[model samples]
Target: MVGATEEARLNQLETQVDNGGGEAWEYLCLVRKLKARRSEKVLRHGIFILNSHIARSKLGGEEWTLYEQVAVAAMDCHRNDIANDCIEALSKKFPGSIRVGRLKGMLLEAKGAWPDAEKIYAQLLVDNPLDQIILKRKVAIAKAQGNLAAAVEYLNNYLETFMADHDAWRELAELYISIQMYKQAAFCYEELILSQPTIPLYHLAYADVLYTMGGLENLQAAKKYYASTINLTGGKNTRALYGICLSSVAINQLTKGRNKDEKDSADLQPLAAEALLKDYKERAPEKLALVTAMLRNIKLVS
Candidate 1:
C-alpha cells in the first residue's frame, strides 16, 4: 500500500479530496470498502495518499485538517456518534479549541443531550467570559427549563452592560405574568409600550393591572388600555375582556373623573356597584369603540 504503485494510483484522488470535491466523499467510500475487506495496507496507503494531496492544500497543511475531514465524513454519512467521537478526539489534540467544542456542543444539544451541551458551554464561558453566543445560549436554556427566576437574573446581569433592549424587556415582563406577578409585569410592559408606543398588547397588560386595583380612577385607565388593545387587535384577542376593561374605565372616570389625587371615598358602595354592573354595561363598550374610532379617524385625517 506504501509502494510506488498505490501512491501513483491515488495521486489524482488525493488532489480531488484536497480541493473539497464530492470526490473526497467518494474517495472515503473507497477507503471503507478496502477496510471492510480487512485491507489495513490499503487503508494506511489511502490515508497517506489523501494526506500527501492535502499537503498541497490550505486546510491539509494544518494538523486539524484530517480530523475535520473525518468529522465531516462521519456527519455526512449520518453517523452522529462517529462524528461526535471524531470531534472529541480533535478537541483533545487541539486542546481548548473553542470551535470544535462549539460544533460538538450544538450537535449534542440537538440530540437532546442537555448536560453535555451545558458542560461544553460552561467551559467556553470560563475561557471567554463575555462570549455573546454562550451568554445567549445560557439564558435560553434557563428559559426553556422554566427557570424564570434564573432567566431574569441572567438577563439582568447581561442588561447591566446592555440596556434599553425591547425584546428582553418584553420577555421578562411575560415571565413575570407567567408567575402571576401582575403589578411588576404591568410596570415592565408599561415601560416597553411607552418606548415603543405603537404596541397595544403592552397597553392592554398595563390596563389589566389597573383593573385589579379596584377603583373608578384605575378603571378609567384600564378602559383606555382595553381600547388600545382593541385598536391593535382589530378586535381580536382580549375581545372577551374588552367589555370589562371599558366598563371599569367608564365607572372610574364617572366617579373620580380622572383625578388620581382623589378616591370615591364615600360609602357609595351600593351606588358604585350598581353603576358598575348595570349602568356602565349599558353604554361603555359602544362608547369606547366610538371614541377609539374617532381617535383613529383623527389620526388619519391629521
Candidate 2:
C-alpha cells in the first residue's frame, strides 16, 4: 500500500493532468521520483503526455528527457514496442550517442538477448573505457546469466577504479554473503562502515557477519558492533537487541571460569534481555511468552 504522502503526491499529479495543464515535464519528474517499481503508472501517464500535442509542445528540450524516461519505464513494463519508438527517436536526434546505445543495450537485455546486450555494452566500454554505467551493466549481465563469480569479478574491477562508491561496496557485500564468503563480506562491510560510519545498516551487517564467523574474539567484536548498531538506531532495532543476547551468551560460554576482567560486561546481557522483553510486551504481547521462554533457556532470564 502507498503511504499517505505518496498517495497525496500521486493524486496531485493526476489532478494536474485532469485540469489539462501544460505541466508535462513536472508530471514526468514527479512520477520518476516515485519508486522505480511503479512502472505501470509511469508508462500509463508517460504515453498520455507523449501522445498529447499540447504537452509535447510545452516540453521543449525536456521532450528528449521524457522520451528516455518513458523508454526505461516501457522496458520495465515489458512494452518493447514503446521502448523501441522512444529509442529510435533518441537515436535520430542524437546520432551515435553512447547514452542511447546504453538504452539499446538495456532493451536487448530486457529481451533476454544476452550476447547481443554484451556486444553493445562491450562496444560502449571500448568507446569510453571508464564508463561507470557500462561497467555496472557488465556486472548486471553476469548476474542475469547466473554467473555470480563473473559478477563478483566485474564488481571488484569496478571498485578498483571507483573505491568510493558505497552502493557498489554494499552490492558486492551482498553478493559475497549470497555466495557464503563471510570473511570477504566482512571486509566489504568494513569498507562501507569506514566510508559512512553513521549508517546503522552497515554496522548491523558487519555485526551479523562477525557473529556468523563465531570465534571467541569474533563474538566479542560482534557484540560491540551490535551495540554500536543499537546506539545508532536509538535502540529501536530488534535484531541488534537479539544480537546482543546471542553474542553475549556465546562470549560468556567461551569465557567460562575466566577472570572477570576478561569477560563481557556483566550487565550487558541482562539489559538486552530486559529491553527485548519490554519490546515484545508492547509490540507483540502474544509472542512475549515465547521470547521469555527462549531467554530463560539461554539463561538470560529467570
- Alpha carbon lDDT at 87, candidate 2: 99
Candidate 2: worst 10 consecutive residues by lDDT? 257-266
Please give, for residues 1-302, the per-residue lDDT of candidate 1 as tens digits.
24566554455565665665435444544555443332332333334544565532644444355555555555444557756765777878778677787767766655667788889898898878877657766777787677888887887777676557777777777777777777777778777887888776677667777776546666656666766775676555434244443454457456545554335422222222333334334656656445445334423211
Model 2: pairs clashing at backbone N, Cα or C within 3 Å: none
Model 1 poorest ten-residue lDDT run: 265-274
Q: Scored by CA lDDT, what does every candidate get?
A: 0.60, 0.89
lDDT of 2: 0.89
Off by over 4 Å in 2: 1-24, 31-37, 257-264
Candidate with the greatest lDDT versus the true structure: 2
Candidate 2 lDDT at 94 equals 100
